[model samples]
Target: MEIETTGIPGCYVLQARLLRDRRGSFIKTFHTPRFEELGLRTDWREEYFSASAKGVVRGMHFQLPPVDHAKMVFCLTGEVLDVVVDLRRGSPAFGTALGFTLSAENGRGLYLPTGCAHGFVSKAEDSGMYYKVTSVHAPEQDAGIAWDSIAFDWPVSDPELSDRDRRHPRFADFETPFVFDAAKAAQ
Candidate 1:
């Protein structure tokens, strides 16, 4: 796999190398050594999958401090427009967001640090996403920034979203709890 850093600090887009033949294809999606070299968390406490239909928008969400998690995400089937925003207060890209097309066809994945908010908009008839998290889910710490609050140009005009996501507070209305520390990051 090849890992490439995104504009946002601590965020990465990982592409897997596909070995193809007449029989089919094989790809190594994850390997601990490569991840360690990149300083990405490999100690995941939980794993989950979500399936959504085209035009469905899922988040702009993250958990606060004690439960904040590092996540590795990829498209298991179909395609999606994955989006993330850096919420770490002291970071240069705080409040800034980035979007990428993650698809089964492309065999790409994303690694997101604890201080970022994550979400995705399905681009295929049905899309399945798999993710590994460094920490378990904590309901009390669950939080989010309204998806529409950020300056993003979503391809879907009328995206299907859950009531909870629709009710999330706007980005400007939330209190950011994490701060980026370059010193700590280097460790």
Candidate 2:
């Protein structure tokens, strides 16, 4: 697999090899040693998959500190416009938004560090998104910024959203608890 850094510190685009045969295709999204070599988190405590229809937007979410985690998200089927925003106050890229197109055909995954928020919009029908996170879901710690608060240009203006997502605080109103550690980020 090939790992490429993004504009946000500690975030990466992991390109895994895709092998195809006469009948089907195969992909290995994770390898302990490879992730170790790249200094990426391999201790995934929880995994989840979300299926969404085209034009569905699900995000701008993250957990608060104490349960904040590094997450790796990829498209298991179909495609999505994955988006991330840096929330660490001291980081140079704080409040910066970056978008990536993750798809089954592309064999790519987005790796986000602890101080980032993530969300994605389904670009194709019956899209499935897989996630491997360093920490388990913590309901009390669950948090998010309003999706529209950022400068990202989402594909749909009136995309569908859940009531919870609709209630998230706007970016400017959020008091972030995450702190950017330059030393840890360098690794």
Q: Please name the candidate that would achieve the greatest lDDT relative to the true structure.
A: 2
- For each of the candidates, the C-alpha root-mean-square deviation to the true structure, in angstroms, is 1.5, 1.1
Lowest-scoring 10 consecutive residues by lDDT in candidate 2? Answer: 178-187
Root mean square deviation (Cα) for candidate 2: 1.1
Give per-model TM-scores. 0.94, 0.98
In the range 1-187, model 2's lDDT, one tens digit per residue, is: 9999899999999999999889888999999999899988888999999999999999999998799999999898999999999999999999999999999999999889998999999999989999999888999999999999998888889989999999999999999998898776622
Weakest lDDT window of 10 consecutive positions for candidate 1: 178-187
Model 2 ranges with Cα > 4 A deviation: none
* Residue range 15-91, candidate 1, lDDT tens digits: 98877789876767789998888777788899989999999999998989888988889997899999999988888
* lDDT for predicted candidate 1 compared with the true structure: 0.88
The alpha-carbon lDDT assigned to residue 168 of candidate 2 equals 96
